[model samples]
Target chain A: MSARRGKLWSRTVFLLILVTVAGVVLLPILYFLTISFASNYEAYQFPAKILPTFSYPARLRYNADTENYTLLLKKGADFEAVKTTSDASDFSLYCKSQLNVLISPPAVQTLFDRAKASDQAVPIKLRKDFFRNYVVFFILAEGTMRALFNSLKAAGWTILISLVLGGVTGYILARYKFRFSTTFSTSLLVVRMFPAVALSLPLVVYIMRMNLYDTPFALAIVYSVPNIALTAWITSSIFKGISVELEEAAMVFGATRLKTLRTITLPLAFPAIVASSLYAFLAAWNDSITALIMTNDNPTLALLVYRTVGSSTIPNLPAAGAVVLLIPSLVFTFIIKNYINQLWGKVAL
Target chain B: MSYLKLSSLKKTYPNGVTAVKDIDLEIEKGEFVVLLGPSGCGKTTTLRMLAGLEEVTEGSIVLDGKDITHLPPRQRDISMIFQSYAVWPHMTVAENIAYPLKLRKMDKRAIASKVEEVAKICKIVDYLDRYPAQLSGGQRQRVAVARALAVNSKLSLMDEPLSNLDAKLRVSVRTFLKEIHRNTGATTIFVTHDQAEAMALADRIVVMNEGRVEQVGSTREIYNECGSLFTAQFMGTPPANIQKVALASSRGRLVAAAGGGEGAMPLDLGDRSAFPGMEGLIGNEVFLAVRPENIAIGEPDGVNEASIEIVEPQGAYTILVTRVLGGEWKIMLEGDVDFRIGQKVSLKIDPGKVMFYDAQSTKRISLS
Candidate 1:
C-alpha cells in the first residue's frame, strides 16, 4: 500500500478500537445514571427505558353514557385508573401522585369542571418531580446522608494510613536491599488475597472487645489492610523508576537524606502517590463486604446502598444511593486520571 | 598533604562484588582530574565514593585536612552533577539552584542573589522561573551544572555529564564546562569513558581498568608514554598496533624477529639503550607497541616492510592500514597523504616512541 493510504487505514483502525473500548466501559455507568434519575413509576416500567421522563403522559376518559370521567395516571407500580363523577374534588390526589403538581381545591375543581363539559376525554399532561428520588435518597432517607459522611471519613483515614505506612514500605522496598526484603514484599501481596470475610469475622470479635465495632474507624482499619499492600506495590514500582541519583544530588548539595526525600524524591514521585491514594480512597468508599461484617449501628454509604438492594422492592431509591456512593469515587478518580497515566510509563525522576 | 587525598580507598558490595579496588590518589587544590576508563572499570564507582553516594568499604578520604570517609553526603561539603542531569522537575530553575543555600539556613535575599549569579554564569538566567520539563535536554544539563556551581562547594564531581548530548552539543558543552571550571576553580573530579573527552578537559587523566587504576599522569604522558599495555591500547583512537617479537641472530647480529612462523622477518632493534638487564633473554618473546603517528612512511627502506591494504582519509590526517606479523598496523600521515591500495610500504617506527611490554605480564618495560 502507499504510505498515505496505509497511514489512513491504521488511523481508522485505531479510532474504531478506541471507540469500542470507551463504549464498553461507559455504557454501564450511563445506564446506572439513568436509573438513578428515574422515579418510582419509571423504575418499575417493564422493558426499561434508557432515559427518564420529567412529566407523565395521561388522558381523562369521559364516558358520555355515565357522565363520569376516569383519570388514568401512572403511580408507584404502573398506570392506575381512577373513575369518579364531575363533582369529585380528588383531582389533586392524582396531581400529587403523577405530576407532583400542587393545586388548590378551587383549581382542582376547575380542572374537573373542564373535563365534565367536554364529551371527549380531555388530553391533559402532568408534570412529574425531576429530582424527587435524589431528594429522598439524600435528604429523606434516615441514615443515607450520615452514611455518606461515614464513607468519606473512612476513605479519608484509609488514604492517610495507606500513604504514610505504605509509602514508607514502598520506599524501603525500592531503595534498600535488606535481608527478607523479597520475602516481606511477596507476603504483603499474598496477604491481600486472603478472604476478607474470614479475616473480618475473626477480627470483629477483637473490634467489639475494644468497643470499636459499628464505627467508621473500625471499618477503615479493615479496609486499609489490602489497600496498603496494593499501594505499596504500585508506589514501589514507581519509586524504583525514579533515579536514585536525584536523591544523591540533593544530599550532595547539603541536604540530609530525609530532607532530600522530602524535597526531591517525594515530589518526583507525587504522581504515583496521588494515584495510589485514589486507589485507597475507592477501596474504602466502595467497600460493602467488609462494611457488612464490621459495622452495624454506623454502616458506610456503600453498605447502606447494598442493604437497600434487599430491603427496597423498587430500584429507584437504591439506585439513587448507589449514585451517591459512586460520586466521590468518580470525582476523585477523575482528578487523578492524569496521574494514573504515569502508571504504564517509567515515572520520570 | 594535597587538598584532597584518597588513601587505600576501596568498595566491596554486600553481594561480594568488588567495584573499586584499593585506590590512593592525592589531588591538589584547583586541579581538574578525570577518571577515564571503559565500562566496568570502576571510574564511576570511585567518583561516587568521593561524592559520598557510595560507602567506602575500607580506608579513608581526607579533604582539606579532615577525614570524611564515613560522613554523609550532606556533611561532606561536596556537590555532584549526575550523568542523567538530575534537575528536580518539581522546582523551577531558580529554586533548584537556590535549594542548597536554603538548606544551609541562608536568608532569602542572599539565596536569590546567589541563584542569579550562578544562572548568569551558566547562561540560564532567562529560564529561572521555568521548570525542568519546560527546558530542553541541553538546557536541563546547564541547569544541573548551574545548581552544582551555585553552592560554591569545596569540590565538584561530575559523572559523564555531557555524554547525553549530541556530538556537536557535547563539544560546545565541554568548552562551557571547562570555562566554568576556570572561573570557579573548584577542585573537580570528573568520570568519563571517552578518552578524547579526558584528553580535552582533564589536567591529569587517571585511567582505570578492571576495577584498578592503570596509570595517573598528564594527558600528554598518558597518550605519549603509556605505562602499561592496557593504557597503550586504550588511549589512542586508531589504537597502537602490537605484535609479539623476539631478539634473535640473523647474521651474527642482534635483531628483533617476528615470532610468526610463516616467512619470519628480521626487524631492527632500533637502539640497545632500552635493554638494561635483557642481554641473556634476547631470544625470549616481547610485545612491541607503536602509535600510528610514530610510524614514518615513504619508501620501502625502513626496518619493517608491509603491504598497504587500505587508506582512510580522516580530514586532518590519512590513515594507512597494513598487515604486520599477520596483524593490522595503522600508520597515520598528516594532511591527505595518499597511499595507493595493495602496495608495499616500508614503515620505520621512531625508536624513542616505541614501547616494549613484558610478553607475559603485559607491564611496560621502562628503560633503567
Candidate 2:
C-alpha cells in the first residue's frame, strides 16, 4: 500500500511539474487572447475578471412609472448616456456609424417605442460599434495577408536563384580540388556570417537610386545573396559525404560524364538541395530589418509586424496580424517534418 | 597475333611517385596473364593503365591494332572488375548486367535476351532482379564478372577480384574464372597479390616488385630456373634455404672441401678452364642454393652431422629445422620423421641438385 501510494505521489508530482512549465510558456499568449475578447467596461473593472464565467448582459433602469429594465437602442439613431453604474464612469455614449446591423422587426419596434414614448430618454445601444475594432482589424489583416504573399513570393524566387547557382557551386566545391578550393569555400562562409542589417543602409540607398525599391524583385535579389552563401556551404558538406566511386562506376558502364552525373551524383545530392532550399526560404521569410529599410510603400509581413508598434497606441490590428503570420510557416514545417531527417541525413531530434 | 599489347607503358604521379616503370606486356588471343606481386608493386597500376583507367606517363596501349592509350575508359572497348567488385549498389543484377547494352541504345528485346544470357552464364539467373546488397559476397563477385562479360570486350582486366572472398570461395571462384577463360577465349589480364592464385590460373606469371619486373615466366620455369636470388627466395612456401660452403680446387678441377675424408663424393664443378680465377680461391666461400625437398635423413656414410632444432609434422610431410652449415635450415622430408628436438641427425645434400653462386655478387655460377 505504501509503495502504491508513493507511485501515485510521484506521478502527481510529474504532472504538476509539466503543468507549471506549460503555464509559464503559454501565459502571455493566453493573456493576449483574453484581452481580445474582453469588453472595455469589463477591462476597466476593479479586480478585473479577464475570463467570463457567466453571461453578463448590460442592464439599464427605466423611469419610475415603468419597472421594466431593458436595453435601450434605436434604429438609424444616436444617443448619449449619463449615469453612475459600476466603479468606472457610467456615461458611456454610443453612436451608430456607417455599419449595417441586422435586427428583428419586433426587437426594432421595442427599441423604437421605448425611446419615443418615455419622457425620460432611454440610452441607445449600438451593436456595430462594439465590433468596429474587428472591422479595422480585418482590413489591416488583409494588408498583412498581401504583405505575407509578397514575402513568400520573394522567398520563393530567392530559393530558385540560390538553389540553381548554389547547387552547382556546391557540387564542384565538394568533389573537385583546385588551387583555391579551401579558400573559396571559407570565403562563402564569410559572406554568410556578414550581418544583413549592416548592409541594409547602403542597400536601401542603392535600391532607391536604381528605382528598384518597393518591389518583390528587389527584395528577392537582396535576399538571394545571403541565401546563396548559406545554401552553398550547407549543401557542399552534404554532397561531400557521398562516395565518388558510384559516379565512376556509372561512367565505366558506358555512361557519358553528364549522364553519369544525372543518373548517380544528382540523385544522391537531391536531399541536400532540398534542405538548402528550406534554409534559403526560412532566411528570406524571417528577415525584417532589410525589408524594413529597403521599402516604404510595400512592406513584408515581418516589416508589417514591426510597424504595428505605435508611440501611444498599441495597434491590436497588427498584433492579430502577427498571429496570422505564424500560421503558414508552421504549416509548412509540419508538412515537411518527415523529410527533415532525410534532408539532413540524420535524425535532428 | 596478340589480342592486346602494352608496349613500354609507364605511369608517374605528380607527387614524383613512379608507379609503373616501362612495363611491356602482351596478351595472346586466349592466354591468361597474371601480374603477381606484393602490395604497391605496380601490378594494379599496370592493369589500370591497360584498361585506360590510369593515365599512362609514356608508351602506347594497343588493343587489336589501334592505339588506345589516350582513350577514355568508356571508349577503350574493355571491361574491368575492381577489387571491391564496383557493382552498382542501387541497380538490380539484370539492370547492372544490361547497363552497357542500354548505353548503346539497344532494343528492349535485345537487352532482355542479352541480360538473360549473361545471367545464365554467370549462374545467377534466379537472382536477376535482386540488388547487390541482398546477395552473398561470392554472388556479388559473380555478378560483377557477369557485368563485365555483358560488355563483350576482347579483354577482361580483373584487379584482385577474388581477394574479398573467403578461402574456399576464392578457390572455387578461381576455378570458375579459369574455366570461363577457357570457354570464352577472352584475353584476360589478372592482377593478384596471392602467389597461389597466380600459380594456379596464370599461363604466364609476371612477378613484380618495387615497380619493376622481377621475373616473368610459367610457374614451372620460375620455380625450376629462377635466375635471380630474389626469385628463388620469393617463390616457394618454405623458400629455398641458402648457405655458404667452401670447396677445394686443385689444378683447376674443383672437388669437395678438404675436411671431407677419402670416401667423400666428389663434386664435378665442370670445366675449370672457364673459371680462370679459381687458382687463389681454394679457401674462398661459395654460396650453395638447395631446395628444402632435396635434403634427406640417412646413415653416416653420405651424411653430415646436424642437430635438429624443431620438427613440425604436417599431414603428408614433415618439416625439420636443423642446424646445417653453421645455421638453421628448414628441411622438407616425405612422411613423418619422428625426430625429436635436440637430436643429432645426419643430413645429405644431393650434389647434382645443388646450385652454386658467386659469393660476392650473389649470381649463379657454372656447376654443370
For lDDT, the strongest prediction is 1
lDDT of each: 0.83, 0.72
Misplaced by over 4 Å in model 2 are A1-138, A141-149, A160-188, A199-239, A295-299, A305-349, B242-304, B310-328, B332-339, B347-368
Off by over 4 Å in 1: A1-31, A46-48, A57-69, A73-110, A113-125, A138-140, A177-187, A338-349, B248-254, B259-263, B271-285, B359-361
Give per-residue CA lDDT, model 1, range B326-349, as digits (tens). Answer: 677899999998778988878776
Give DockQ for candidates 1 onward, in order.
0.48, 0.19
lDDT of 2 by residue, B1-368 (tens): 56787788888988899998887777777788999888998998998877766789999888998888998778877787878887766577888888888897889999999889888889999999887777889998999989888888877889899999999999999999998888887888999988889999989989887887878899987676666666666777687877666767656555544232334344334346645555665666776667889787765443366678988999799999976645568899998768878877677665555666667876666534
How is the predicted docking of candidate 1 categorized under the CAPRI scheme? acceptable
Report the lDDT of model 2 for residue A150: 84
Model 1 chain A weakest 10-residue run by lDDT: A340-349
Please state the interface RMSD for every predicted structure, separated by commas: 4.2, 5.7
Task: Give candidate 2's error at residue A138 in angstroms.
Answer: 7.2
Q: Using alpha carbons, what is the TM-score of model 2? A: 0.73
Q: State candidate 2's DockQ.
A: 0.19
> Candidate 1 lDDT, tens digit per residue, A151-202?
9999999899988889988998999989999999999998689888877888
Clashing pairs for model 1 are: none
Each candidate structure's count of clashing pairs: 0, 0
